[model samples]
Target chain A: MSFPKLWSFHGGLRLDGHKQESTRLPLRAARLPERLVFPLLRRDGRLAAPGAKPGDRVLKGQLIAGGDERLDPPIHASTSGRVRSIEELPLPHPSGLAGPCLVIEADGEDAAVEIEGLANYREHPPEELLRRVHQAGIVGLGGAAFPTAVKLAPAGRRIDTLIVNGAECEPYITCDDSLLRHRADEVLQGAELLRHILHAERCLLAIESDMPEALTTAERALREGGFDRIAVVPVPAIYPTGGEKQLIRVLTGREVPARGLPADVGVVCHNVGTVAAAYRAVVLGETLTSRIVTVTGRGVRQPQNLEVRLGTAIADLVAQCGGYTDEAERLILGGPLMGFALPSDELPIVKSAHCVLVAGRGELAGSRPAQPCIRCGACAEVCPAQLLPQQLYWYSRSDQLERVLDHRLFDCIECGCCDVVCPSHIPLVQYFRAAKGKAIAKQREREQADRARRRFEARQARKAEEARERAEAARRKKENLEKSAVPEIRQAIERARRKRAEKTDQHATSDTPGRS
Target chain B: MLALLAVCLLFALFGLLLSYASRRFKVEGDPLVDKIDAMLPQTQCGQCGYPGCRPYAVALARGEADINQCPPGGEDGVKNLAELLGVESKPLDTARGTEKPKAVAVIDEAACIGCTLCLQTCPVDAILGASKFMHTVIAAECTGCELCLAPCPVDCIRMAPVRETAATWRWPEPGAVRP
Candidate 1:
């Protein structure tokens, strides 16, 4: 397994993967939840509006809710069911706030609505292909959940390169690694489809150099499939070498501008898992029904990667992994660094779920009292973004908003590198997050204030216009009266008197006739 | 004598070039210093043991300020600083205090009167209601520094454990494994 083209970055720590227990186990299917609560919002935090009413019978893969075309992806039914109700339910969100959800009671019959398969999807135009992808509710399954169609769509500028990210850079995450080892062919096929869609000149599949087996498997698949233009490039096993921007820089040596996207530099990056999903969608006309998820940690009775449905509960997934050990103190969704800590096992797995870890209490039991920073330079040594973490922490702590922005606070990817290597655990990431949150809140406040100002201005303009119209009407009436002579005025007065008299006479006549 | 003068002139020219080169090539300080400084938990608690968070940030930029300092900032703050500084981190400095999970500021709603002291102390304006009314801490804005907890004259303020959501749930550290 000679992975000649592998590249990596500096400053990443290698934790024990503990993958042996689960890597060899064949993928298992997760049992369905009795009731499915599907959130209308999945991508970029924008909520999708409900398309179905209460009591509507929906089949699996049926469109139940649709996103606003501008920023949302359409949502579909995960199973055949009757709409129980459209109500507020606890969504799988960090905020833990209840969002509007479509609740469905499973009918136990996995019935699916008829889907229109592309007779020759590969032959279809790129625009049409992207349209189907949007309608299919495809999102980046690699945890970002970015809308896939938006990535596939041609940018305002030309796209020359497409990088397929296969760097399963997180310590415990092996879903992508396993996918490469087991399903390399699908990944390559997906890559080819992406190339065709983007019409890109170069297609590079970037994988970590650690997994030699995956590299070989991917190489063989690429060669067997005759994808000559697609190169399987191995990146170094850095912690966040798998981050889109970092991977792009390592592979192409092109720095994705800070806060800018790979597409801005004529490159579009896709997660290997995302590409596999695309292949399934475009090649087999399959919707995103199931995905390969890595289930490994110290607290699980068993550890293995399993194929699970979109709305499967974490509890069911855990049971599939032979249930949790008594020592299991915490459960995390996704990888250890970026994964969210799950409040409960009842949370449903969505498209972005990659790993479900059950770690023991003892495994997480170290509590260090935060000490004063002794001005150690260790954080800068490990920052892949070349940022000054200590300074940002200071400004954020002081609530100095201007200095935080000046430091390009938005460019921080929150990868947890500086905190990991710090001699003193400064909780650097929290300060950055606090600053970012404060910044966002401040921006929202400013926007609201601007909107209020605009409304006030509009109201004032309307009021002035109304007053002017009233004054104009009064002047016109006065002019008409002034233009008339004395005789004309007398005649007009007599006419008005006659008209009033006639109206009174008619009213009296009608009343008298009715009485008679 | 002329050759000696020529040699002296050559030395002077070399000295000038060296000074000019040194000035031109001096490493510019990172712009992220200010931002990283702002993100520091400004309890000015001197928990980082420096004069303040600002001095610590300068030291951090000058390769000072260990990533693990302010206990008030906790693990989240450490992670943010790590991201900002572009460094890897280990466990929180055990010397400072172990990083605990998320907690929120809780006011014992039953503790008689609202003195409004906690409201004035809150940096983010997290406390709500008038001076006379019972004030509440907005859990979202509360950093859980326990700064507000100490100011309560009646010991009415308590640090309540933050509600765990699927989002805040993290896998227990692998080191928790006892061999």
Candidate 2:
């Protein structure tokens, strides 16, 4: 096994991964929920315009919405059902904001439309394959939810390496780990296909050392399949190691330039699960309808790894885990570190769902009165991106947006590492987020201001031209009057002066109302 | 001289072997203890039904603690710590404190008499302003643990919830949207 160069950054909190319970449970298909609340917006922030209204019949895997040119991946009906309602509902957002959602009541028939399959991956051109990928509505399953085709489309640059991220570094996330352990062949085949599609020279699969079984299984599959170009690289088990940039850095010893992507470094990283989804899309012509979710928490009565369909309700998934052991204090949608707390279990799962944690009262209990920053350098030591989280925190706390940007606040992934390790228990991530938000808003504001200024300038120019035209017409009229024998000059001047005075008064009042 | 040298060499060799044996035979405690300690919100707040971050880390290492004991860290912290320590993270320990969206210390400027009581009591120096001037909270620094809220004699300090923006927006968990 090749040892990837992993760095120990400034600040990182070592959290309990809590993966053993679910890791032991083999992947099981979850029973379909009575109702699946399929969200129209599956890709990042952009929602697909709903195609079907309430009471419309839709088939399983049928594209319900999304025709925006802006990378809006189609949202498919997870199950054959009647469109129960098209209404604004609270998504699994951290802020608990409501977004447009499609509610489907399952008719109990697990029906799917006949999908057209390509004979082999080699038979199709790259553009055709990319189109199929887009049609399948496959997005980055590694939580970014970026449209997959956009990622596969080659830029006007040379590509050399394809990094397969199997880090599964986030705690409580065992879906990728389980997938690797169970379906190594499919993952390798997918990697091979991705290599062909991208026309990449070599592929590297990076997995953490802690997952020995997955590492061994994947390695064995690669060797048996004679995939010499693909090498299984075992990296140090570190939190956020699975992050695309970090994983790329570990495997290739390259830093994805700040504000740049892996492709910028001549590398494209795809999650192992995402590659599997791609393969399924290319080979089976199946759209991304289901995914593996690690369902485990102390509050859960039966911890298990499940292959659940998209739009399955958290309540139903939790029910399959033998229900909550006690009144769940907090229900999280993803792994704890990056996951958001669900207001209730009624929310349906999206493609990004990897783990659902039902936290119990005991688990939910904690106290650390926010204290002053002791200037502990713990945050700098564990930062996977080698960023100064503490400094960013300092600038952010002061609302010094300029200083925050100077410290590369945009590079901060908001992984919550600094906040987790702060001796003062400061919400470091929130501060950085607020600061970044302000910066983005400020930029937008500036752009809008520029636009307004331009518009005003245009209006002023128009007014000036109109004034010139009026003056010229008045001059011409005076000249013509002077040329005429009976010139009514005094009356014309009086009328023009009165009109000018009225216009000036109106302009002055509108312009300096406060001054007046 | 040769006898003395041999004796010294033998002693050195014996010392090295002893040290190696001790290291090899020593029973290793939980490696996750330090990691769990590190992942803690580290507010030093005793709201976790424990004394401090270190004590909770020790308890977690000993399997005497639940992963979700830190309310200040909220659900995300619990999940993260649970993931790190290789244990099943529970929900926020609601008995100690309910897990709500994070809030920060906010001083009501009108009500505050500038007593500086809340300022001194603040753990993270989140409350700003010198004595006799109107105090304001550095909202970013405030952990929203409500430590400063209790110290204000005039009831001027309030826990203001942090507002969400496009930057702080996270992908909603799967199945979190209800019809």
Candidate 3:
């Protein structure tokens, strides 16, 4: 069948599709680990305050940590377990730092909390759907882990299309594809629900053209479920095509405004995994406790996708996949292009994790000393965000933050397309990331300075006002005393005059008698 | 002779226009002071030997104070000021105080004498308390100025260093590690 005409983004790479090894086997349930360590911080690095204390028994799907509705979503227990001590633990981060995590020891019963699914989700208003999505703690599972409810609301923007991203553009990440193959109906149901919530005219599910099985199954599910408004479209299997902005551009010939969101372009995009999770959340009334994780790489003995619970340690997943091979040289979370090298296997998985790639020695690109930029302009040619990576690198290296900002530094998506094309191997994305951090810090400092300046000025004005009022009060008191004293002095003078007149009259009479 | 008179009248007309333009666009205050104040970081700390950031800014604008006297602004701050004022950047004047890491004061509520000394001393009014009641510093508002340390009779306040976590972690600036 002929698909509709598709638009293209600026620059992308055609990397080796190392996806077959994982998709060869069917999806399997992961073995439960003895302990699950849930970091109190969300994937975006904000704290999710713990609601369950130590020693408290938490059932599966129970809320363990609570967070703000929009930015931070509440975390739920993946399995029935007793709360262990919440303390500092190694986290999955490029910095290899530690954060506060809620530890839970599995009770082995695997019992779940009582849940009630909504039978008539269609009747509920869009606000109710967003509220349920927020309570379910569903985030963009394609790896940003941004709160889904916030994206769905659109803040009064008119949405014409909803893009369900199934591209799974990153190599070796087949969790989304496997979800489509197995639960296409649920995914389609989610698309329909999203369409209803958005009141969009059309819903397009964009899958990679390479995954014919996923495309067919999703289309079939669309027909069987009678989701007439939803269409399954196949996009080119190019690296970084699955990015929110890139996918939106490919699906619709529109550009989301810089520093804005997809909603700004009259569209809202969500990962296919996030859409399915939303369906389950609103219909089944189940909170997002577990997700499908792909454990694959040349370093692992068995490479396949497993439905794993969140907060499961990396070591547990590796063991469940028959443990790491002898050549397992490094553990990288997500994919080779954008993922970071994890420090240890003890770090627990969070919502954003899609793949745990344990690469063998020389399996991926080895680090080399970066040479000075040759100014080949190749990085600029391949930058998906249409940025001058070379200029950004120069400014970032010299700590020229203002110039970097003037170059539209925030628009760089860090998709590694420029890094791949850079002949100097400058690690361009790292410089951009560091520069972005500095810029944000600079902005925050400016804000604080402005705030402090305002407060100081306010205080000065208040003190000046108080001094003026005090001076005015003192002057009024002096004037009132003078006013009252003037009248009293006048009465005293009149009385003195009368007394003197009386004395003079008496003297006059006595003098007259003497004179007579 | 006629040409000379015409030239004189034209000069007079141009001079009148210049004066009127200047009066129409008269600036209210010293813009140099505002520019210097904007770069001062607004800590309100008197480490510069002035009463506050604005006073120091005024002094700098008036050529009365050096640009390196602010300890909170640090070396970078000095560099920015130097660039702004077209002066050579100088090292921080350590006689005032050495630059310290950003930190906020935390009052030990138990030991707080309820003396309100810190409350009265806080320039920003970041501390919230009444007479005979324990005071707490709003960390977001506190500029990490240690002026409150001197006034506390019971020594309840201490500067707690901010911890770096995944949330607060910044990608470190790249250093030269070339082989």
Query: TM-score of every model?
Result: 0.70, 0.67, 0.90
DockQ each candidate and list the results.
Answer: 0.03, 0.02, 0.50
True contacts kept of 1: 0.03
lDDT of 2 by residue, A220-320 (tens): 99879998778888877777778887777667778788888788888988989889988888888788889998888878888888999898888888889
Q: Model 2 residue A229 lDDT?
A: 78
Off by over 4 Å in 2: A1-15, A41-46, A68-70, A361-367, A465-516, B1-179
By TM-score, rank the candidates, best first. 3, 1, 2
**What is the lDDT of every predicted structure here?**
0.75, 0.77, 0.89
**Per-residue C-alpha lDDT of model 2 across residues B41-151, encoded as one tens digit per residue:** 556556877755667788878878787778766786787887786777777878888667656677889888988988766545567888889999876555555767777
Over B39-135, each residue of candidate 1 has an lDDT whose tens digit, in order, gives 7655343567774456677778777678887675667678878888789965577687666655778887878278898875664456786777888
On lDDT, the leading prediction is 3
Model 3 TM: 0.90
What's the C-alpha lDDT at position B144 in model 3? 81
- Looking at model 2 chain B, which ten-residue stretch has the lowest summed lDDT? B170-179
User: Candidate 1: where are CA atoms >4 Å away?
Assistant: A1-10, A42-46, A67-70, A364-367, A485-516, B1-179
Ranking by DockQ: 3, 1, 2
